[model samples]
Target chain A: MHDKLREHIEKIVPLSDDEFSFVCTHFSIKKFKKHQFLIQEGEVAKHAYFVVSGLLKLVYTDDTAKEHIVSFAMEDWWESDYYAYFTQTKATMSLECVENTQVLCLSYEDYKKLCDSLQKMERFFLEKANFGFVGAQRRIISWLTSNAKERYDQLLKQYPALIQRVPKSLLAAYLGVSRETLSRLAP
Target chain B: MHDKLREHIEKIVPLSDDEFSFVCTHFSIKKFKKHQFLIQEGEVAKHAYFVVSGLLKLVYTDDTAKEHIVSFAMEDWWESDYYAYFTQTKATMSLECVENTQVLCLSYEDYKKLCDSLQKMERFFLEKANFGFVGAQRRIISWLTSNAKERYDQLLKQYPALIQRVPKSLLAAYLGVSRETLSRLAP
Candidate 1:
C-alpha cells in the first residue's frame, strides 16, 4: 500500500528509503465498501483520500436534491472536498466509494507537517495541484464550446477506461445530460 | 509593482526584506495597452503574468473562428495559458488586455529558481494552486447545475468588481450565453 504512495510521489521527486518512510508516517490506510461515503455533505472533510484501488466519486447535491458529479477518482487518483479540507469548513460536497476501495488518507495537519519537514513533498504536491488546475480549466473550456456529443467523445477519448468502469446513468449525470441524451450519443 | 506581488505572496506566507528582494529578481515588469495581445494563439506562452493593475481576457477561438472567453483576470489576479506556459507548448488560446495592464512576468526557469531557493515561495505557490483548483471545481459544478441567470448572479455575488469591469459581450462569452441572453439576465 505504501509502495503505491511512494511511486506516486517519486513520479515527481524521488524519495530515499528514509524519506519514503517519513512520508508514509503522514498517511494512514483505510478501506471502504462500495456506496460508503468518505465525505458527507455538511460535515468537515477531515482527510484527502488517495485511492490505492477501486474508485470514488466526488459529488455535489443541488437545492432540488439532484446530484451532480464533480469528478471521479480511481486507482492512483486523489479525491476530497478540498475547499472544506483546506479551509476547515463544513463540506458542500460529498465523496462516495464506487467500489470496494482502499485509500491512503492524509489530514490537513499532517499534510502541512510533511511539507514543512520535507521540501520535496511540497514539490510533489505543487506538481499535482498544477496539473489538477489544468484539468479543471480544460473541462471548463469543453463546457463553454462543445455540444453533448463532442463532450462525450472528448471524455471517451481522454479516459476510455473510466467510461468502461462508470455506469451509463452516472456518466449521464457527469456530462450534465439526460440518460436519453447519453443513449443517443453512445447508442 | 513589486509591492503588489509581495502583498499577494504575504497573504499566504510572509517573507523578509532580503527574501522578497530575491523573489523580485526572478520577475520582470511589462505593460500593455487595452486590445493588446499578451499571448497569441500558436505562440509559446513564455510568461505567467501577475496582474498589478488592469484586466485581461484569456480567449479560445473555436473551429468556426468565434472566440470563447476562457476567463478574466483583473487586478491582483494571475493570467496565462498556464498549460502552454508550464509545458512550453504553443498556446491554443490567446490572452489580451482589457484595460491598460501592468503585469509582473515570471518565466518558467525563474519560477523553478524561486521555488528551489525559497521554501516559503513553494508554499505560497502550493496554496495558490490549491485554491485555483477549488475555484475551478466550483465553476464546473455551476456549469453542471446552474442556468445562465443563476451563473451570472453567482459571478456577480462572488466578483462584483469583475462584473463591473467586464463588458457585457465578454461576460456573455464567459457565461457561454448570447449577448441578448445576458442583457435579459442582467437587465
Candidate 2:
C-alpha cells in the first residue's frame, strides 16, 4: 500500500529512501467496505485519501435530495471534500466507496507538515493541483459545448475502464442525464 | 502595477521588500485595447496575465463557430490558456480583452524560476490552484443542479459587480444559455 503511494509521488518527484520514509510518517492507511461512507455531508472533512485499490465517489446531494456524482477516484487517484478539508469547514459533499477500498489518508496538518519538510512534495502537490484545475476546466467546457451523446462518447474514450466499472445509473448522474437517456447513448 | 501583484501575493504569503523586488523581476507588463487578443487559438500561449484593471474573456469556439465563454477575468484575477501555457502547446482557446486591459505577464520559464527561488510563491500558487479547483467544482455543481434563471441568480448574488460589468451575451455564453433565454431570466 505504501509502495503505491511512493510510486505515485516518485512519478512527479524522485524521493530518496530517507525522504520516502519521512513521507510515510505523514500518512495512515484505512480500508472501507463497498457502500461505506468516507465523508458525510455536513461533517468536517478530516483527510484527503489516495487510493491504493478499489474506487470511491464524491457526491453532492441537492436541496431536492437528488444525488450528483461530482467525481470518482480509482487506484492511484486522490479524493476528498477538498474545500471542506482545506478550510476545516463542514462538508457540502460526501465520499463513499464504490468498491471495497483501501486508501492512504493525510490530514490537513500532516499535509502542511509534509510540504514544509519537503520542497519536492510541495512541488508534487502543486503539479497535481494545477492539472486538477485543468481537468475541472475541461469538464466545464464540455458542459458548455457538448451534447449528452458527445459527453458520453468523450467519457468512453477518455476512461474506458471507468465506464466499465461504474454503474449505469451513477454514470447518468455524473453526466447529468436521465438513466433512460444514458441507455440510449450506451446502447 | 507591481504593487498590485505584490498585494495579491501578500494576501496569501507575506514577502519582504527585497523578496517583492525579486518577484517583480520575473514579470513584464502589457496593455491591450478592448477586443484585442492576448492569446489566439492555435498559437502558443506565451504568458499568464495577472489583471491589474479592466476585463478579459477566455473563449472556446466550437466547430460550428459558436463561442463559449470559459471564464471572465477581471481586476486582481489571472487569465491564460493555462493548459497551453504550462505544457508549451498550441492554445485551443483564445483570450481577449473585454475592456481596455492592463496586465502583468509572467512567462512559464519565469514562473518556474519564481517558484524555485521562493518557497512562499509555490505555497501561494498551491493555495490559488486549490481554490481555483474548488471554484470550478462549484460551477460544475451549479450546472448539474440549476436552471438558467437559477444559475443567473446565483451568479448575480456571487459577483454583483461582474454582472454589472460584463455584457449579457457573454454572461449567457458563460452560463451555457442562449441570449434569448438569458433575456427572459434577467429581465
Candidate 3:
C-alpha cells in the first residue's frame, strides 16, 4: 500500500526513501466493504483518500433524492468532497465504496503539515489540483456540447475499463442521462 | 495592476516586497480590445492571463459552428486555454475579450521559473487551482441537477455582478441553453 502511494507521488515529484517514509507517516490506511460510505452529506469531510485498490464514487444527491455521480476514483486516484475538505464544511456530497476498497487517508491537518514540511509534496499536490481542474473543465465542455449518446461514446473511448467496471445505472447518473436513455445509447 | 496581482496572491500566501518584485518579473502586461483573441483554437497557448481589468470569455466552438462559453473571467480572475498552456499543445478552445481588457500574462516557462524559485507562489497557485476545481465541480453539479431556468436563477444568485455585465446571448451559451430559452428564463 505504501509502495503504491510512493509510486503515485513519485510520478509528480521523486521522493527519497527517507522522504517516502516521512510521507507514509502522515497517511493511515483503511479498508471498506463495498457500498460503505466514506463520506455522507451533511457531515464534515475530514480527509482525502488515495485509492490503493478498489473503486469509490463521489455522489451528490438532489432534493428529491436522485443521486448524481460527481466522479469515480479507482486505483491510484484521489477522491474527496474537496470543497468541503478544503473549507472544513459539511459535505454536500457523499463518497461510497463501489467495490471492497483500500485507501490511504490524509487528514486536512496532516496534509497541511506535509506541504509545510516538504516542498516536493506541495508541488505534487499543485500538479494534481491543476490536472483535476482541467479534467473537470473538460467534462463541463462535454456537458455543454454533447448529447447522451455522444457522451457515452466519449466515455467508452476514453475509459473502456471504467465503462466495463461501472454499473449502467451509475454510468447513466454520471453522464446525467436516464438509465433508459443510457441503455439506448450503450450496446 | 501589480497591486491587484499582489493582493490576489497575498490573499492566499503573504509575500515580502522582494518576493513580489521577483514575481512581477515573470509577468508582462497586455491590453486587448473587445472581440480580440487572447487565444485562438489550433494555435499554441503561450501564456495564461490574470485579468487586471475588464472581462474575457473562454469559448469552445463545436463542429456545427455553435459556441459554448466554458467560463468568464473578470477583474482579478485568471483565464487561459489551460490544457493547451499546461501541455504546450494547440488550443481546443479560444479566449476572447468580452470587454476591453487588460491582463498580466505569464508564459509557461516563466510560470515554471516562478514556481521553482518561489515556494510561496507555488502555494498560492495550489490554492487557486483547488478553488478553481471546486468551482468547476459546482458547475458540473448544477448541470446534472438543474433545469435551464434553475441554472439561470443559480447563476444570477451566485454572480449578480457577472449577470449584469455579461450579454444575455453569452449567458445562454454558458448555460447550454438556446437564446430564446434564456430570454424566457431571465427577467
What docking class should model 1 receive? high
Q: Give the per-residue lDDT digits (tens) of candidate 3, residues B44-91.
A: 999999999999999999999999999999999998999999999999
- lDDT (tens digit, per residue) of candidate 1 on B51-167: 999999999999999889999999888989989988999999999999999999999999999999999999999999999999999999999999999999999999998999999
Docking verdict class for candidate 3: high
Output the number of the DockQ-best candidate.
Answer: 3
Predicted candidate 1, C-alpha RMSD = 0.7
Ranking by lDDT: 2, 3, 1
Q: Residue B167 lDDT in model 2?
A: 94
TM-score of each: 0.99, 0.99, 0.99
TM-score of chain A of 3: 0.99
Question: What's the number of clashes in each of the models?
Answer: 0, 0, 0
How much RMSD separates candidate 2 from the native structure?
A: 0.6
Global CA lDDT of candidate 3, please?
0.95
Provide the lDDT at A71 for model 1: 99
lDDT of 1 by residue, A82-148 (tens): 9999998999999998889999999999998999999999999999999999999999999999999
Interface RMSD of 3: 0.5
| Residue A149 miss distance in model 3 (angstroms) | 0.5
